[model samples]
Target: MSSQSSTQGAALAPEKRETFSSRKLFILSAIGSAVGLGNIWRFPYVAYENGGGAFLIPYIVAIFCAGIPLLFLDYAIGHRYRGSAPLSYRRANRKTEIIGWWQVLICFVIAIYYAAIIAWAAMYCWYSVTKAWGNDAEGFFYGEFLNTADTVGVSFDFVPNVFFPMLIVWIFTIVIMVAGVNKGIARANAVFMPLLIVMFLILVVQSVFLPGAIDGLNAFFTPNFDALQNPAVWAAAFGHIFFSLSVAFGIMVTYSSYMKRKSDLTGSGYVVALANSSFEILAGIGVFAALGFMAYNANSSVDSVVSGGIGLAFIAFPTIVSAAPFGALIGVLFFGSLVFAGLTSLISILEVIVAAFQDKLGWGRVKATLIVSIPVAVVSLLLFSATTGIYLLDTIDAFVNQFGILACALVMVIVFGSGLGMLPKLAKHLNRHSSIKLGTGWMVLVGGIGPAVLAYMLINEFQAKITEQYSGYPAWFNGVFGWGLCGLLIVVAGLISLIPWSKNSKLEDPEYDQHQQNVQAEAVPETVSKEY
Candidate 1:
């Protein structure tokens, strides 16, 4: 597994893996993944609640201190090893492969429900034109659209509205997955990221022109400098940025694995991080401007109109669309942005799962895409398209994202940075080809600051979730689907990691030989262009 030869296992798997043709595509794809539903819906409220403008202080600190460092950590491993998350970690050191599988499982869980939100947004894009959720947006979203049951239990009673759209979303996802990385992911990001930016910009411009729009913008931008003294506000900045950039997950790792060996790993990371943060700030502007208009219309304060996550996307935004003039345009743009952002993120999440199987089972891209995606699509449809879906989605999302990501990330940096003693090796690998060379400070950031912050976040989340049923969901519901599902993922990850890697995957990575030689030589790669 240490060295690779093209001819070493010709019969096992003949197809060579794909790579992004340029640094530009990789940066675009990475940004597409980072700037997702969270950037649009979550960041605006987080910043508003955290300290308004002052949140940027910790947000930027968290970026340099934690976000970018972990991002580079993912890049160094994936690009240096030139394989999927499992293969990359296995090649790095065998003991660390389980961490990769844990991330893969987390992505699988996220992708399934993530599609439902995208489907909902896609439907809202149409509903915006029709003014579908008339009279009562809240009742329409829950009682009518989702059709909540009296109790928290699964049912076959599918809502045709949700079912059809979700089915369409899954089919679109399946097609994209089958198209392979370059024709599919790269091209999709190429199109969707630009479209998302343009649509959101138009939406923001329109919202800014609305009556009382300045009230929302002022509420969002006016910094409560006093709030900076609160530890929770600082934690909020770190937490939001931690999630915003999509680092330490299997996503960045898998995406980076597709980059060329001599690529500018760090430089591309900085670009992705910057674009992601900038988009989040822009989203805050648009969302709160709309919120300000909503508050003005309702004769209430901006604080009363503020909401985040599902409430912001489905309820609050829908209310804004209904009340404001040119509301239909607002609805289409806002919901349309969600669809674009969610779809791009959904693609990246599924790639983590598909790439893992491709490497582990020695399957070609088409075979792996079909084999991995179809069953997942079926499961996603069954779970998320029914009346019971909202409860399951809410509970599972809280558990996996709030608990799973931080837990896996903490274990990742600790295991890779310490247990395997791979940080020094990884740091060297990064500096060899990257434009901005890393030093001990980067290492310290990844090893020391990253873990401490993650540990603190994990402890706080655990205390909060464990202390009470999350979101006032029933204890049985939280226990089985929340804590129980999280526990199940780790168990599943350990078992999956025990499986033997196929000959083609573990035995045949020709570029990996060049990588090891580069590490041994400790010089710039021969493939490196004069640009560096």
Candidate 2:
């Protein structure tokens, strides 16, 4: 087929795009994408709630069986096709292309709110110097800083402090995006990842020396094995693994697509997985140690100071830092780490949206970066950075994560793993180029085991939603901002997918390389009907 042939998607047309300079750079970037605020704040609480130290067993199991396996699948598909999620999916099976668009849309929503959190981190970094949050950290965070209003309604009231920091966050993200992949994403990760680890390690060491550090460690590591018997504990483990790894967000798919053809897909996936999980455990230790100190001083227990999500980072940690020895320096290291972690993850999320625009519309890096980043900034400042920002952030996060992100992954896994019989083919591709070869067992994990777990998670979330509104907001609020917002994303993705693709895409050209077509041919089952 001619490269000019309109039949094949524009993504297949011969073209050169930036790639990571080396294997190490790619792996670090991938690790950076996976390591985020979630690793630091979210996972520790999850482990505590599930089974404390015992949670590691199921969490590790979920990593190999579901998380790493899916990571490999995403790597295999993207490396073979060498396109962003939308273009790559379209090339794999025309019908499944919408899945890519769905992921990108989910990423768009994530980028807007994710940056807002980063802005909080940036402001908190300065606040650390003066211990500005005072003893009542929660009160200052919710009352003075956020000036939070009723959860049921949206607030347009501008909080200039929030807006300015958020503007910086967006500016930093856009400048990095404009740098392109290697110089931008890889280089940024190369710098930030090490700094993040060092700062976090310092925090952990400082935290462990405190009077009640052992008490914090006990609460974090003491295994409540009986909790393991509950199915919800198992579910939490799997869910944490999935969320922490940054899978199903089109990030791994997009990042892997930039890999050199000779890159070790399986080995790289393993590295990223292990690195992410290891950081999570480290973060749990540091967080709990700090909380333990807080409890000791307050004449309370670890449970009193323990929290997760934004509360843990912005409120609890600040509270702990204020009363601790060398409060200024410790607070700086803690929140500074948040700044680094948040930036790396934010860029990855925004990259998905930027790549979508560039791939489908053939826009230059600068053009695509501005088009997507500006609207996101406006949304962040106006809607999500206000006094009511937390409300919108929580609602959108719940619905988008449950319905938008997980839903896309579930559908993709079902269609490709079972419907089209792509699991083995993708495994073959991974093993062919990767140093660590995969086998039939990997296929079983991805095709059967992973999807079943994901389906259960999705169903469980729905059941929980039915019984009680997520985070206990008003039903009307959940209906609009939660489900209603998610529905709008779907509509937007569908509309965007209808845009005309550039025929000049290298993937469309047979001469650029016949390998992509061969991989797709092998990936699709001949007996499968064309309709789906």
Per-candidate Cα lDDT values, in order, are 0.88, 0.85
RMSD to truth, every model: 3.6, 5.0
How many residue pairs collide in each prediction? 0, 10
Residue pairs in collision within model 1: none
lDDT of model 1 at position 504: 65
Q: Which 10-residue span in candidate 1 carries the lowest summed lDDT?
A: 523-532
Off by over 4 Å in 1: 1-15, 515-532
User: Over the full model, what C-alpha lDDT does candidate 2 score relative to the true structure?
Assistant: 0.85
Candidate 2 segments whose C-alpha is farther than 4 A from its true place = 1-13, 506-532
TM-score list, all predictions: 0.95, 0.93
Encode model 2's per-residue lDDT on 1-532: one tens digit a residue. 6865765767554556668899999999999989998998899999988889999989988998899988888887777667789888887886777788989989888888888888888888899997787778889888888888855578898787788899888888888888999878889999999999999999999999998999999999999989979999998999989988988898998999888766788888889999999999999999999989989989999988789988899888888778889877788998899889999999899888888778888778889889988988788789877878889889998889766777788888898889988877677778765778777898888888888998999898878777888788888889998888778877877877777787544436243266555545564545332211
228, model 1: CA deviation in Å? 1.2
